[model samples]
Target chain A: MDFNFTPEEEAFRDEVRAFLDENLPENGTRDMEAVAEFQRRIREKRWVGFSWPKEIGGGGGSIMEQVILKEEMARRKAPALGACFMGLAWVAPALIEYGTEEQKQRFIPDILDGKYQWCTGYSEPGSGSDLASLQCRAVREGDEYIVNGQKIWTSIAMWSKWMILLVRTQTDVEAKHDGISCLLVEMESPGLTVRPIKNMAGGDMFAEVFFDDVRVPVENRLGEENQGWKVTVSALAHERSSISEVYGLTRSLERIKVLAKSCHRNGRPASEDPGFRSRFARADARIEAMRLNGMRFLTKQLRGEPLGSETSINKLHRAQLEIELGELALEIEGGLGVLVQGDSAVPDDGLWQRHALSWPEVVIGGGTPNIQKNIIAERVLGLPKD
Target chain B: MNFGFTEEQELLRAEVRKFLDQNCPLEEVRKLCETPEGFSRSLWERMAELGWVGLTISEEGGGVGLGWVDLVVVLEEVGRSLFPSPLLSTVLAAKAVDLNGTEAQKSRWLPGLADGSRIGAVAITGDEGRLDAAGIALEGRPDGDDFTLDGEKLLVMDAQNADILVVAFRTGSGEEDLSLAVVERSAKGLNIEPHRTMDLTRRMGRLHFDGVRVSADALLGSAGSAWAAIEHLQDCAAAAVCAEMVGAAEGALKLTTDFANQRVQFGQLIGRFQGVKHPLAEMFIDIESFKSLCYYAAWLLDECSPEAPLAVSRAKAYASESFARIGVDSVQLHGAVGYTWEYDIQLYLKRAKWARPAFGDAEHHYQRVAKLRGF
Candidate 1:
């Protein structure tokens, strides 16, 4: 197999490198204006949605080109291509796939321009991994739907101007997955309330959004009235590059390596300690494995094959890798690992501790390891259902 | 960049898989357990006829000019069958010779090896079988144009069946002052002693030498300067070992999965239990990771990338351990029958466990990686 990029691809990579060299924020810090400028320039270059169709204001790049763009951007530690994270990753893609012509004209451009933040309303306190069991209700009214629901773990709800919501429109369907529908609701609509919730790392990045008779026009529904599951399914398919996550892991591992160099055990650099070395090397190897697997996943997608349950393999690997890398950081820190951010003399301002406490986002929020394992076994390995 | 197999490489893989399916079935592996030589000579020749014996031998040397990536493709299938043979030794040793052998030396050895007329074994470790500087046990003393080699090489793979032994010996006390020599097994002062290893499909032996005199022509590369080449050869071997493991673990996991699907328990399939199925799922995950890592390492080696050394260690360190984990889980998932002698699962387990410390296990590679990444 050839690992070398074709000359044209390499030249495109060079062009991306040149752009990044000029535009990437110094040391990964981008002020508000700089972020806006970064977004504007990438939009001009059509690099924001490099693989999306040009008709949708995207770059219309090939799959490998997209991989190249991401690999380079991640290697340089550049800011994300757009300011609206969920919007770019899922909301826009979902809208493009299922939106009406008017809806596309109204929403896609704003999302591409990063006009405002977007939040998701899916899981309630009682619904998590079994998200289709959500109890949120959206009753049909003339020209509009009256929504009433409580969505816990609704990330960015407090700041987001809109929410892509999943609500139960027909509760009597034979299957749990059949009755749900997706809705786009303006956050400013009356009867909506958001109470911020602090995560274990003490960050108020998400909230509990309460919907009390918030009316959304019938036209705002995504896909068919009882087929929101398909929208959600298709939207969820737009994945963040796990290879980029591998790069992030590589950076974190490098930090731990540096920490180990300075931290000493038994009068030797912790890097020289057999235990520390073994664990660190294992982290390195696991990341490499994940990187290679990411490439395989990319290959499958490029070949027009559905990813199916294989993505769970890397998801599970990431969960364990995240936990291991976080623990390794703290292990290298020794007693100082106990200190939280802002503490005087805390290592990297307690970044490792914060990461260690924030495993829920990487592990539990999307799909717990148990859930991923079940999917892999039943779907991928063709094992009997558990 | 495309990180995938070419059409040719993919076809080679399918061919190897089909060949192993026909020539080296589980029953064949079990039958060879009783064979004194461990591997069938006819089977080796048949494989040679397929050009896999010379799979990676240089085209300039009258063999296929494929790189380590192609060799890895064949090695993975070899691992899947648990086929008893000296392909690994011959491939690895032939590579060392190709890398360092003179024109005349290549002429003398490469043709015979490529045509399956000769077999080769490489001995790089001492009795400890630890693949590191501390484990270099054989000492070389100069006798004019010849060197008298003394000291035993331990865990020499298929040494008893080899026609030539390419040995690593210390020419001086310094770790870097080591040399490699290709010696005929018929040398008067040399002996091969077989060992009953845990993995019956693959035999192990120890090479004994008492002032075994070898002419200057037998020495590979410059005298006392082959240490770097040896390390490079080890890295290549490390990559091969990882590839082999990817096959072995994948095979073992498949067997256990099939068993889990059919084996009834408490009036239900055992696989319905999360205890049985989840571990198997986890095993699948581990196997895929090993496969990916091994393939990438092979790619790096084939490309001659500067990252080859680190990638090789990473693959070896992870694949070896992951294979063992799958082996244990396979047996545990299979229950009592898995532990029986009549069962074939133990062979995979033995090879998996044996592979861990065979080529600088996880711990050794960790040190290598730490050093490479700048300890």
Candidate 2:
């Protein structure tokens, strides 16, 4: 297989590099005004959602070009393409795929413009890995759905202007995946309440959202009633670019390597310690494996093949690597590892300490390692289901 | 940037797989392993006719000029069948000659190797078993038009049958002074003793060189400058072994998966138990990941990328460990039958354990990676 980019692709990569060279702020420090200006410029260039369709104000770039754009941005350590995380990642894609014409016009532009954030409402207190068994209830009336349920682990719910809520519109179904429905509800709805939950790392990036008779207009329902599971599944499967995740881990590992050189163990730099060196090198090799695996996945997508359980492999690697690297960084720090952000003696403001404690977000959030293994077994390997 | 084989390469893979399935089935492998021949001459000749032995050699060298990526496909298939042959050792020797041999040397050796009229073996490690400068205790003392060679080399694969031995020896005191010399198996003062290795699919030999005089013309590259070529050869060998391990691991996983699907336990198929199924799943993941690494390493070497060395080391290190792990788990999932000599799974287990430290073990490659990463 050819690993070299085509000349045209190379030119596109050069163009991305040129754009970043001219516009990316020195040191990659972005204040509010600079961040706004940067987003505006990328949005103007249609690089923000570069893979989305041109008919929808996107760059309409090829998948390869999108990868180049992302690689260049990650190399320069530039700010994320848009301020909206879940919105840009999944919400807009779902909307474009299944939303009504009016709904797309209403939400797509704001989401692209980074005007506000959007959070998902898939995981309930009782329904996690078994997400299809969600019990959030929404009964439809004349032109509204009376939503009433609680959604735990609603990431960014406290700050998002809207929530892509998954509700149970019907219960009497043969399959658990059938009765679930997707609804777009405004955070400002009268009966909706968001109680922020502090994570183990002492951050409130997510919340437990309570829906008490929240009146969402029937028009806000995504796709057909009782067909929202299809909408959500298809949306999540929109474009599998877990390859982009590799750049982040690569950068993180680089930082840890630098720390290894500076941090001391047994009166010598930790990087010189045989044990630490082996760990660092092993982590490095594993990350490279993930990157190559991502390329394999990208190749499948490029060949017009729909990605399935293969993505879970990298998810598993990412989970394990994130935890391993975080712990290794703290171990390099020794006693100083226990210090937090505000502690005076903390190294790098105790970034490693928080990282060590914050692994559940990556390891346990999307799907646990066990779930990923099950998917690989039953789907990829064609083994009998347990 | 596609991480896949071309259509022609895929065809080559399918053809090799079919050939092995028909000609080198498990029974044949078992039979050959039992015989002193260790491998079938007819199968070797047929594979040579298929142009596999000299796959990466240039057309001028009397073989099809293909890249490492193409060779990787055939090697993977060979690995899948557990084909008892000297293809790997022969290819590695051919690679060394192709990389450094002069026109005269190429004309003298490559054609025989390319046509499979002659077998080749690479004697890298000595008694210490380290694949490095320290491993080559053999010393080749220059005397006029010849170099007198004297040392012992151990664990030389297919050495008993190899017509040509590519021997690494110390030409000077410095580590970088290590050189490689091509010596004939019929050399006057050389002895080749075959060892009954635990892995019967391939045979190992110990070579004793007692003042064996080799013409200076047989030096593959410049004297005292063979370390670089030797390292490159090691990388090539490691990557090739990784490809083989990937194939073997895939084979083991397939057998285990089928067994789990059919075998009944406690009134249910063993595959229905998460306890039995999850390990198989884990094996699948490891194989897939290792396969990706193998393909990437093969591509990097074919492209001659500067990162090829590190990539090869990564693939080798991972495969060396993961293949062994998959082998153990596959046998475990198969229960008692997997442990029997009559069963095929034990063969894979032995191959995995044998290959764990063949070119370089996991720890050695990890150390190499750490060095390459500037740690």
Query: What DockQ class does candidate 1 belong to?
Result: medium
lDDT of 1 by residue, A1-386 (tens): 66667889889999999998898777656377886788799888988866667898777888778878888988988878877888877788888899898888898888888889999998999999889899999999999999998999988898899899999999889989999999999999999999999987878988998889999999999888989988965533333347878888889888998888887788787887888888888888888888889888887776666777888988998999889989988888888888888899798878899899998888886789999999999998898885
For model 1, the stretches where C-alpha displacement exceeds 4 angstroms are: A28-30, A235-241, A303-306
By DockQ thresholds, what CAPRI class is model 2?
A: medium
lDDT of 1 at A180: 95
lDDT agreement of model 1 with the native: 0.85
Tens digits of per-residue lDDT, candidate 2, A1-386, equal 87789999999999889988888876646477887888899899998877788888677888788888887888788888988978888888888899999999999999899999999999999999999989999998999999998999999888889999899999999989998889999999999999999988888998899989999999899999999898875533334657778888988888888898888998998888888877887888888888888888888888988788988888888999999999989999988887888889888877888889889998998799999988988898787776
lDDT (Cα, 0-100) at B281 in candidate 1: 87
Residue A262 in model 2: lDDT: 86
TM-score of each: 0.96, 0.97
User: Interface root mean square deviation of every model, in Å?
Assistant: 1.3, 1.3
Runs in model 2 lying further than 4 Å from the true structure: A27-30, A235-239
Error of 1 at B117 (Å): 2.1
Q: What is the DockQ of candidate 2?
A: 0.75
TM-score of 1: 0.96
